[model samples]
Target: MIAEYADRVWRGESDDSIVDQGMEGKGVKPIVDGVGWWSGFGNVVAFEGSGELALFDTSSPFSAAQLHADVRAWSSAPLTAAFYSHGHIDHVFGTGPFEESRRATIYAHEAVAARFERYVLTSGYNAVINQRQFQAPGLRWPVEYRHPDVTYRDSLTVRQAGVTFDLFHAKGETDDATVAYVPEHRLLLPGDLFIWVTPNCGNPQKVQRYPREWVHALHRMAALDAEIMLPSHGAPIFGRDRIRQALLETAEWLESLVTQTLDLLNAGARLDEIVHTVTPPEHLADRPYLRARYDEPEFVVRNLWRLYGGWYDGNPANLKPAPDAVLATAVADLAGGAARLADAALDALSRGDERLAGHLAEMAALAAPTDAGVHRVRAQVFSTRAANEQSLMAKGVFTWVSSESSAHANRLGAPE
Candidate 1:
């Protein structure tokens, strides 16, 4: 019921404010009389109606026990319905809290079961990618998943005593994404579908997301004119007009990117051309909420190309390109040597040509992975690139690259 703590948690406010307000560490806040959101790392929204409770997203297993403890404290009412927003581990692993609820029925899209199976098969691969993505090398991908008992195809509405819970499927962050709506309360729950930040539709390491379909999904939610939107990742958005604008504007941002990418795709522009040239609608792009905090637009563009054109990128040379070392060696030989290539990368960085700098820098490192001078220059170049990036994903990747280069220097006993 405390919006202040939720706001404080998001605004990076005082730790005492949270503790003083009785929210030890969990960021749970009641949206209305009975509706509540437990915003730990990911959100688990709760709705109390029909003399029972409906929870949206159970959160990761890491915090599931705590969530159960808190939700129980909030109301000992049995969980009538537990909605799995999508197949993401963070959203699904917490189902243990409701495992014993005889009245609670798990529900999700049909694709969620398949996603769980895939996660089980590629748990190791998922762990590595997740570590790189989050910069947490120790993060483990979970094999345990709570499969949904009730699955829907397009849409489903369940009537519980006096309230109706409408569930609509959309392909945005994941193929098995769902957005829950409460018509009576004029509230909407978009599971990572409409996070306050830019839509996470451009995940570089994970499966492909539907950018255009994401736009449609937002439009659908906007049409509801839902006064409140409880997103999975960030704080809740209140007000009908503000909610509509956030949803529509998010859709508009995606539409602009998709249109620009498709235009280039139709004109036979290679992925390289599209990635560098596609411009974001600066009017909307500069917004604090739309700022590239997580997935940036360039990755989204690359995803678009992949969706329409596959891996080929309409470039014959990239179809079955030479090995990285071979290509780097060939380029280094042409530029006189690896040292010359690193010098050129530094020059590109100086010229504010980060794209060129990154390309040439990677080539420089691959060409002479053992050379101290090359590693030093590559480290400096990538460090600069990381500093310039606004998105967390981009920064993590560039910072990791710089760290790798620095590691090479450490191994060689190079001077600091």
Candidate 2:
């Protein structure tokens, strides 16, 4: 898979250079005595002499057959147990591979069970729309949800192979998030709570996230005095002080969002106004860990609104809506033909007005996807804008759009 990813990059077939660089030659390495986030998506913690192994968060991409092959490269320790930090598909779906190797008991929060059940019921609906959300083809939600054999509500302590593993449940990026702490090793495995780049408590295209609760969860994890913090995504933090600083900063960032949202709501400001006004502090904004790579602050505010209020975004016009295509056609007709709108969008791009250019270019793409000139202009504009974007959320969205435009241009036989 890594080779295939590299080949795609070399062939100029994909724009995932960052991901490719991160994964290149980065096979699993042991942390402390036994803990490791394997070459794949999960982590493994083994007991030194007992050959006892505990796995955390099995990932997809590789089926059971493939995972078995990969696991052999690591230790041949007998799998004792599997712990799911959350009910997310990436964290649990690959457990089938481990289950086949040994009779591993699965442990997770009780809420994880409910989450799995919900996924089973809504898998079809989730599969259909997931591609659009992540801009990936064949992104399907798994229907086969393996329930946890052991479930806990708040906390659970398990001692195996002379090492004590502490599991603490807290609602963070996911409703069923669990943080595993090994006091003996001073290692903290905080699933998605600290996903390296950002907390991901505000995924714009996904389900609701609990930002306030995530902030509280981070604070709690920071207070644990753990020396090493390993996250579900990205690299690990080794020092106690560094881990504490990261967690504290992330909490402060989320707290700022929560406080700003409440202040605006109390001031009777509308949703759009609040979103425009409430900017995260510069210190938080400058931090690499807090970058909005996957989720933005606006989405966090929206999630808070859903948690405190309801689905309605306090906008009466958005309470109900006509079919999107019908409304889009009407809007296109009002702005004249899509080509004319696209020409105007090009003019906006020329005038260094990216905000307006982005809006118009999007409209042009939706309105006249077949137009070669529209696709070219949209690609160029979005690419330039993406290069200048500071926020990862904006960068990802724009880069995806740019890629889409380039794909369309290729389909139309336009020159690169």
List the global CA lDDT of all models.
Answer: 0.81, 0.72
Score candidate 1 by lDDT.
0.81
Per model, how many backbone clashes are there?
Answer: 1, 0
Which runs in model 1 stand beyond 4 Å of their true positions?
1-26, 98-103, 160-162
lDDT of 1 at 217: 91
- In angstroms, give how far residue 319 of model 2 lies from its true place: 3.4
Count clashing pairs, candidate 1.
1
> In model 2, where is the ten-residue run with the lowest total lDDT?
15-24
What would the per-residue lDDT of candidate 1 be over residues 1-416, giving only the tens digit for each residue?
A: 35564445344452221012224356456778787778666778887776787788888877888888888888767777788889887787665766575646888999999999999999999998878767877888888777898999899998752567799899988899988898888989988886667778787888888999999999998999897788777766677877787788888888999999999999989898999899778888545457667888999999998888888876788789999999999999999999899999999999999889889988988998898888888899989988998777787778887888899988987777
Best by TM-score: 1
RMSD of each: 3.6, 5.9
